[model samples]
Each structure stands twice: as structure tokens, then as C-alpha cells.
Target: MTNTNNSLNSASSKASPKCWPILPAAGVGSRMQADRPKQYLPLHDQFLMDHTLRLMLSYPKFEQLVLVLSETDPYWPDSAFANDPRIIRAPGGSERCYSVLNGLRALEGMAAEDDWVAVHDVARPCLHHSDLDALFSAVENSAINNTGACGAILASPTRDTMKRGIKQPDGTITIDHTVERDQLWHALTPQVFRYAELKQALEFCLQNHLEVTDEASAMEQVNKQPLLVAGRSDNIKVTRPEDLALAELFLAQSLNQS
Candidate 1:
């Protein structure tokens, strides 16, 4: 894949009912204990966001990439793709849902309501191409036939026993009960949805003051059951400091395979 970035103006004529990627990178990852946002942290020799942008740009399916960053973000200007035209910037919101909404609004005239939008986490730098293919296939088959909801998320089934915990006033924690793990899945990113459907779902959640932990939850409030496409477990979100090393390993493995 070429490293060159195309401008949104140049790709407008080619835009149609195709998938677009919305990347939200506005969070201050306190857990990372880093001087800058985790997305701006260096991995190998480049910023983490660069790895992610390159991966998404490598995919020919996406028409353009919408990147939402905080208004006060200082690290973005230093990014390798800071001047890349293919990437359109959207002002980040206070919350993740709001940021995603802003990105959708940025594509107002460019993307049709029925077009697919894939919302991915900027911290997830190791998203494999095969997993992306699976998500696209699942969304296309289900959305086109109306056999399933147009929204779908890449997830992995829980592998370990789950539990509910109760924090005592003394700062001690106790298990409330052992929970059944069957039918439970860990939701991952690059959640795909119809442009209009996702926008409406998020608006509905905001109106109702409901908590939307992910895109799937917003759709659920509207009684939409999004399909879950199983993805590789290594598609990890870099939250803590240790996760960065693991992501590097995964990226290396992917490169060897390619």
C-alpha cells in the first residue's frame, strides 16, 4: 500500500455507498501514565496513531477517514499524517458518543444515509485485515437482505469465568456472585452501522440520558440487535502501559504473516 494520502476533495467524486472509518482519539488516557495521549505515544519509531491511520488507509474499502481529536490536542500537529488530505478532521466532543456524532455530522453531504460507517478506536493499532474483511462481509450480507440489523460489532466471546464484585466500605472487595459466562461476548471496535441508523440511535440515547458504553448499546436502546462478528483476540485496545508492548508484538506478527 502507498503511504501517500489523498485529499477528501479528490475522493469526493469516487464516494458512493461505501464504508467510511470514524476514528475517535480525544480521550486522556490517565491509566497510561504518559505525558501525552496514548494515541500519540511512540510505538516502534512512529506515533501510535500513525500505525492506526496507515492500517485503515491500506484498506481500499473505505472512501475516506474521519478523525476526531480534542480541540486542545497538541500532539496531532506533529503526526505524520497531520497534513494528509485523505483525513478530514472533526472537533472532538466531551464524550465518545458525542465525538462520533460530530464525525458523522462532518460527513453530512459526503456520505449517504444508507452508507456504512465503521467507528474504530484510535488506540487499537493491531486490527487485522482478515478481521476487517469478516466485519464487512457480515454487515453487507445482513444489511442488504434485511435479515438482521444493519449495525454490527467485532467482538470476542468471554473465555474466563466471570464474577460480580461488591466493594465494602472498608475498601475490601467481595464477590456478589459467580456469573454465567455463556452467551457473553467482549465487544471490540470498528463497529459498523448504517449512517442514518447510528446517528438516530445516538441522538435517542442522548435524549433519554441513557449510558452508551459503545455503539451497540446506542442501537440497542432503539431495539436494534446488532450482529457480533468474531474477531482475533489480539485486536487489543492500548489502555495501560503494558498493552503497548503487546500491540507491538501483534503488529510484528501480522507483518511476518503478510
Candidate 2:
């Protein structure tokens, strides 16, 4: 669980607040219907999380990366990154919010109050570099203007025709109305926020019994509106068996472009 002394330490000594990535990989991922957690599942030749970690570590040089995993998870010891010096391990919690919260708590002594913490989903292995640039630029610009109170996230505007469904007594789902898609956006990770702000927000939600679907939702519960930085639609979360193929394709395309 100890962070290795590396360039990350020197990087954090800079004038600007450093960015620390926290990946909550504790979920069972029941939708994937796999023997192991979706993160541990193979994508191409490497594990899905291997791709995500590589993408993240390649860009932003950080003090350390925090990985929240189930204490009883047997797959992590076999991962390529298991012995990496720059990564720290934290105990997983029951839910996504709890996992994220635990990850934040793991940084209590190491992270400064205003340091940025990007809470990313480990299942999202196809996040593009351009999206990360856009998100970081927006948040840093806002900080310079003293307007980044709510932080920011990479999101894509809804493209498909939206539908609102209602369940019937017979267990059938019927469309209730056509939802307006103009203002809707699919929230994606690398949801960035100040360390203290995000920690407090998640704590507030958990203590109040509020539902926190993501970091932004937790901030929203505390009357904050996070900026939605437009990102590539290809940045998808591998949730089902079919998504693995799609993720692999996207990853290959990203590599070719780079």
C-alpha cells in the first residue's frame, strides 16, 4: 500500500495543485456475467484495467494512483500493475460511492485540500487523450478565474432520441413520453474536482442517505453544478459482454491515431 518514491513526488512540488487519479474497481459488475470482475477481464491481450491505467499514467504525471479493490479479490495479485510502485491500494466498499469515498480517505495524509482528484471508472478503458486535455484545461482555466468551485467532467451530449418509460402492472415497460435530449449528456469519467471538495461532497451524501450515482451527483446534492466538458462519444464503459468487442475496437483506433 506504500507509494514508491518516484517522479510523482517531484511533480507534486510544483506551483499548481497536482492531480491524483482514483479508480474505484470494487464492483461485482454483475451485468458483464464474467467469472472475474470486469476490470480483471481480458481485453485483447491485457486486462481491461491495464489499458485504463496505461492511458491515465501516460498523460498526467501524478504523485500516486489509488486503486480501490475488494479486500477478498483474488485477481489483483496477478495483475501487471499489482507491484507497481506508483500505485496505492485501498480497501473497497459496498457500493460505487462507498468505494470512491474510501479511495478519497486513503489520500487524507498525502493529498492537499485543493489538489485535484479525478475519480475515474476502471471499466472505462477507451478514454481518449483529447478528452483528458479538454477536461483538465477547462478545470484549470476555471481555477485561474476563481470559478472552479464545482469542478468538471468529460461528458458527451445525448445523440439518440430519448424516451421515458413507465412500468405497467403486468411487468411491461411502455414509453411515457419523448424526453428532450438537447440538454442531456452522458456523464463520463475522469470526473475531476478538488480533493477536499469531492471528499466532503461524498461524505455528505453518504451521511444523509442520498443516492450518489457519480462524483458530480454527490456535488449536485450539495448545491454545486460541475462543468460538462464535451468529450469523445467513443469513451465508453465496458458494462456488458458485448461491450468488450467495442472497447477493443476503440482502443485500437486510438492507438492508430496516436
Candidate 3:
């Protein structure tokens, strides 16, 4: 039941890359405090969700792109993402973890549980097509008979010196020793993982009552080392007002490159 209208038949269906279901159009933008949810906000002529969706939709080998969002969300209709025939929807959950869990449920006992699933943030729209190439390559190389973990995330080395700033007993400011830049690396998305491993990692976190932020955190809970692919530094999350301007700049750069 995979869509193939927009793509040609693959020689090796089992070996071909699987679909990447992105979690978008969720959460209240407390930081942006925009007129609507940040994912629905307009970025140029396209919605924030469009940028991420378009990137995946452009790939020919992918069979589908499942988008998870709140059922109560006012924006976006079933026909909104019509260009991509493989696009599907699922109800979102309370937290990001919950939203992702619901997304996983939509494919449970349906898709190959050990196949690949990529989860990305809607606000991070700077992922170029080349970044996906690196991710896919890593997944193809690592995954062995569906049991190998093929988790790949974009990250960059910290250039600036970082310190832990804390308020002393008397409310005095204290800056701790400079953190080792080489040892610290910033993680970004879209984080790709094997379906079974991703589910196991997430379930382990929830079952143990662990408050995890990203997929990598869940993997860490299971002693899995996610392979970090150096992603473009421009791929940053848009959370505040000033970040909008930054996003625009990155988008413009992408356009210029294209």
C-alpha cells in the first residue's frame, strides 16, 4: 500500500530506502508567541511544515511521509500536502515525546517495525538535500538484516568557549572553568533511526519515567551511540522572534545555492 505515482518502480524494494515520517505542525510556540502555532506560520510563500515536507517529498526512493499533528489544530487540511501522494497524518500527543509516540503507533504492526524512520523538527527548515544524502548513506551502511542501529543526526563542533554560569550563595554571579570545545558538539536533526530500536529506546525512557528531549537521549538511555553526521551549521531551531530573521537568511542561502 505504498504510494508510487510520483516515483518509478525500484529494482530492489526491500533494499530501497524507506519513508521518513516527520513530526510537524504541533505544540504552542510559547517562545515565538506568534499568532498561530509556529509550524503553520508562513515562511516566505510556504508554511513552516512545507519546507521540511518538501525536502522529503523531493526524494524519489521514499515511499511515504507521515506527518503528525494535533487533531485540534486549526490550520492545514488533508489536501494541503497533495503534491506528495505518500503524505499521511496522525494525531499528535501532549509532549514532543508523546507526539512522536503517536506517530510510531500509526505505523505499528503496519510498516516494517525494523525499517527506517526519520523524525525531524518542523521549525528546523534549513536541512538541505545533501544532508539527507549523508543520513541515508549512514543508514544503508549500518543497518544489517534490520537489527543494526542506523541512527544518524546532524551536529557541529562548538567553536566558542562555554562555561557554566551559576548564582553563588550571596546571589553573586560565578562563571565556571571554560568547557572543552572539542569535547562538546551541538546536535541537530533530522535524526534517522531503525524503527524497532527507536521504539525500544522511547519505550525504555517512558517506562523508566525518564524525561528525554531528543531521540538521541532515548538512544543513550539504552546505551546506543548514535552516529553524529556533521550537519550544516545553518540548520538551527527557530524558537524566538530573532530566530525568524536567521531562518530567512538560511533559506535565502539555500535558494542561492540551488
Each prediction's whole-model lDDT (CA): 0.91, 0.90, 0.77
lDDT of 1: 0.91
lDDT of 2 by residue, 1-258 (tens): 135555667665764888899999988899999898899899889999999988888885565799999999999888888899889899999898999989999998899998999999999999877788899899889877988467999988999999999999999999999999988999999899999999999998999999899999999999998999999888899999999999999988877887
What lDDT tens digits, residue by residue, belong to model 3 across residues 1-258? 355632445645665546556665568888898998877777877787778777777776466877887888777763357445677777888888878877887787667765778888878878777887888777777774454554877778788888888889999989967777775889888888878888888888999999789888888888888888888888888889888778888898888978
For candidate 3, what is the TM-score? Answer: 0.86
Model 2 TM-score, 2 decimals = 0.93
Model 3 bad stretches (over 4 Å): 1-13, 82-84, 144-150, 168-173
lDDT of 3: 0.77
How many clashes in each candidate?
1, 0, 0
> Arrange candidates by TM-score, highest first: which order?
2, 1, 3
lDDT of 1 by residue, 60-174 (tens): 8975799999999998889999999999899999999999999999999988888899999999999988899999899878855879676789999999999999999999999
**What lDDT would candidate 2 get against the real structure?**
0.90
TM-score of 1: 0.92
Model 3: how far residue 234 lies from native, Å: 1.2
C-alpha lDDT of residue 213 in model 2? 92
TM for every model, in the order presented, reads 0.92, 0.93, 0.86
Clashing pairs in 2: none
